[model samples]
Target chain A: MTFSTDIHVDKVRALLQAMEAGDERCTVEILDDITQIRKSELHQQLSELTKNLHQTLDDLDVDTPVLLHAKHDLPDITERLQYVLNETQKASDKTLGSSENTLGLLEEVGTMLEGSDEVSKIQPLLDQASQELTNIMLAQSFQDLTGQVLNRVILIVTELEESLKALIERSRHDYDAIPQKTQSEAEQSAEHEKGVGPNVTAKSKLDAVESQADVDDLLSDLGI
Target chain B: MQINRDMNILVVDDFSTMRRIVKNLLKELGFSKFDEADDGATAWPMVQSGKYDFIVSDWNMPQMTGIDLLRHVRADEKLKDTPFLLITAEAKRSQILEAAQAGVDGYIVKPFTAATLNEKIQKIFERVAEKQNK
Candidate 1:
């Protein structure tokens, strides 16, 4: 039982004026038209909103898992985050091990220096320490790997947030509102061809290889 | 033919950290000359301009993909014989097959050890030498 504000007010005023003039037929006709217009307007609004919502849902494929089901994508995100945690942990362990070994080598060098200033004796120890330090630096590569994974997760989350925001904003407006445009099919499909960065859950997937050995085996079988 | 330890190498990856790790590993393997590119797009220009003896690349990148770069290199009459190795996180059999089909000299999945990289590089050089001899 809703009507557009200006139209409803003007129609009611016209019907009252008609009634005052003892124009019963005119008043009845005005009332009928008002009811018909309101019904049509409401129906149009409902259909428009439904269409916009459908478009939003269709455009919400940020990733394969997100495209399939949002709930299903949650566990995948968790697994990706878990991978980040494991990578960071391994990096820290490697860094610590290298640092400790470097420290031990430095201590040995210090003792040798205290005993005698032989360049040959100190050089090997210093070289070993330098190698360990390089190991420490290499271990920091985990940051890059984990950062890429987080960026992907963030992208999916951001896409979901934007879709939800659009839905909310559209729901607040009437049927006469312009529809939000969606991404083209070509653009969405192109994202699939781009390589999926670091398979965090490779162990669980049958299509993905878990190790370099697996890759080597496959390549050898192909005679490469 | 003996592998040249002093040969110029081009390392292509989007991540600077990865490039540094690869460079350090190569240094450990006695390779002294090195160059780096952030992606295949940037690497392709360098590959065209420079006389790189070897190319190591990552698969996924924003502007151009490693596989595309590999194809470009292989198609070039002058650079077709340059050794190209793919080091990437893309471990699918299909992707490995694609690299092989595109004439990749070596393929090493990410999270690979220095030993694996060394082994792959040695094997690639050996095969290239054998092909040249034939």
Candidate 2:
């Protein structure tokens, strides 16, 4: 079994040690009391980490993929998120282009009427034009608000960037603590072809949740 | 064990995020010579055309896969011995075994960090150097 920094609470660790050494009375209750608090704590950290990482990603102008629910699934979410970001940017660009076109039309009309003595006739036309101008100005004003909202997102993202960097760094440290097998697994893929890709091993991921006790054991078998 | 830092690096994956992540990691590792392809199919011709010294590829991609790409690389008289690393999320014993048999220069399981990449790349370089010595 892998040592969990997560399950490092004194009481829980002690309980696990006590229970592991204990005899047949070792029931689900032992697993429960020791792991319950730690499990909940881990759940909290995961939620917090996800929330922070996503927020930071937004600051970096990244989108959260609709399909991303967990870590093992990042590849899918990253793909979908790219599409989402692409579509969003396209829509935003279209909106800005439409607004710019309206502004251009208004500018041309204003320029044409600049020296006309038909100020009275132009006055009524100008009234309609001026109303349209106000609408354009209002729209432009809303654009400023959009820009401000973008800035706020940027601010929050900066905060999350530092947070996630720390989290990843900490995880790396934890990973280093886990001993890896000395044997080389480098040449085996050529010798066999039955398994899928190395990155999307869903079996291990599923096995992660249902059986934490088996996590280290299985990874060792995988030579990781 | 040194990677020719100036050599062109190709980052291939169906996921743009991963491509970006790998690129960024490469940049962080002080190598900015890079390009990207979304899958091995799209990446194949580029590898054929470009003088790529290092290729960091994802195992599972849309058009072509890392294994097929690796085989293609080994088959090519010109591209042989170029470093080919497969980075993936799969961690099953079976898949790991398969990648080994494919003669991948190095393998990295996903959700990995910059440091892990450093370790794998160094090990790959060392292996390559050892073989060259022999």
lDDT of each: 0.79, 0.64
Q: How well does model 2 score by local distance difference test?
A: 0.64
The CAPRI quality class of candidate 1 comes to medium
lDDT of 1 by residue, A136-157 (tens): 7776777777777786776777
> How far off is residue B48 in model 2, in Å?
1.3
> Which residue pairs does candidate 1 place in steric collision?
none
Q: Name the TM-score of chain A in model 2.
A: 0.29
Weakest ten-residue segment in model 2 chain A by summed lDDT: A61-70
Over the stretch B2-114, how does candidate 2's per-residue lDDT look in tens digits? 67678798999888878888998888888979988888898899999857888998877766888789889988989977889888755555555566666676767666779
